[model samples]
Target: METSDKVIHAIYNDDDVLMAAVKTVKAKRFHIEEIYTPFPVHGLDKAMGLAPTRIAIAAFMYGCVGLTVATIMMNFIMIEDWPQNIGGKPSFSYLENMPAFVPIMFELTVFFAAHLMVITFYLRSRMWPFKKAENPDPRTTDDHFLMEIPVNHGNERELHDLLSKTGAVEINVVNNTH
Candidate 1:
C-alpha cells in the first residue's frame, strides 16, 4: 500500500465518544485511515461503515473438509487396511459401524474449524509470530483511542479543526513519510 505523506491523529478517551466522532467524520466525507483502540469496541465497524466479514463462511468450509478427511481416514483404518474384531463387533462394513466413528468425525470437524479459522484470521490481518507492533501511539495500547485521518491533498488544517471540535483529547498532524 502507498503510504500517506501527511496524516492527522485524533485521540479520544472514551469509546462512546470515539464512535460518535467516527460517524461525524464519515458524515463530513473525510476518509478515515485507521482507528486503534485498547480493547474491542462494539459497533465500531458499523459506525465506520465497514462491510460484514466472511469468516463464518470460511469456517463452515473448513469444517466440511475436516468431516471428509475423518470419514476417509476411519474407513481406511478400520475397514479397508486392518480389520479388527473388538467386543463381538467386527469391522466388516463401515456403514454398519458408522456410530463408532461419529465422535471422531465431530471432534475433527470442530478442531479443524476452530484452528483454521484462527489461522485465517491471522493471515488476513497480516499478523504472524514475531511481527513488530505497528501502532502509532503508545497510549493507544493503554487507556486511549486513536483515529488516523489521511491529509488528502491539503486538508490537514480543515481536518485538524474538525477533529478538535469532536471532543478529542489530543490531536497531532504528522508527516508519515516512513
Candidate 2:
C-alpha cells in the first residue's frame, strides 16, 4: 500500500495541547492511527485506550520453561551422569542437596525470559537493527507532538479543524514514502 508515501496530517507542539487534542479525537470516536512525541507522556496510553502490554505474561512463560529445563538438565547431569556426594549429602536428593544449583537455575530463568522477551518485542514491533528508523518527523524527537491521521474520504477538513482547535502550534501534511 506504499504506507510510507501515504499523507499524514500532524499537529505539533506542547504535550498538554496534544493531550487535549487526543482526548477530543478519542471522545468523538475518531480513529487515530498513531501519535509521536519526544518523550514519554504520562497517561497517554490510557487516553489512547491502548491495552496493557502482554510481554510480562510471555516473560513469565519463558522463565517457567527455562526453570523446567534447567532443573531437568542439572538433575540428569549431576545425579545420573556423574553422581557425587558432597559432604556426605545424598546424590539422588534434589531439594536437600541441590541448593547449590539454585543460583544457576535462577540466572537461567532470568536470562531466558529477558532475552526471549526482547526478541519477541523486536519481532512484534517490526523493528530490526539494520532497518532505517521510522521517524515521521525528526523534530518530534526534539520537541514536538506528531499526530498522524490516515487519509480517509470526507474526514480531512474535519480532522484539520479539530487539530487546529487542539492548539497545534504547527500542522503539516506529510507523505510517507517508504
Off by over 4 Å in 2: 1-6, 176-178
Residue 23 CA error for candidate 1 (Å)? 0.3
Q: After superposition, how far is residue 38 of candidate 2 from its true place, in Å?
A: 2.7
**Using Cα atoms with residue i matched to residue i, what is each candidate's TM-score against the true structure?**
0.93, 0.84
Q: What would the per-residue lDDT of candidate 2 be over residues 146-175, giving only the tens digit for each residue?
A: 887765655667777877888887766666
Clashing pairs in 2: 4-176, 4-177, 4-178, 5-176, 5-177
Question: In lDDT terms, how accurate is model 2?
Answer: 0.81
Count of backbone clashes, every candidate in sequence: 0, 5
Clashes of 1: 0
Model 2 alpha-carbon miss at residue 21, Å: 1.4
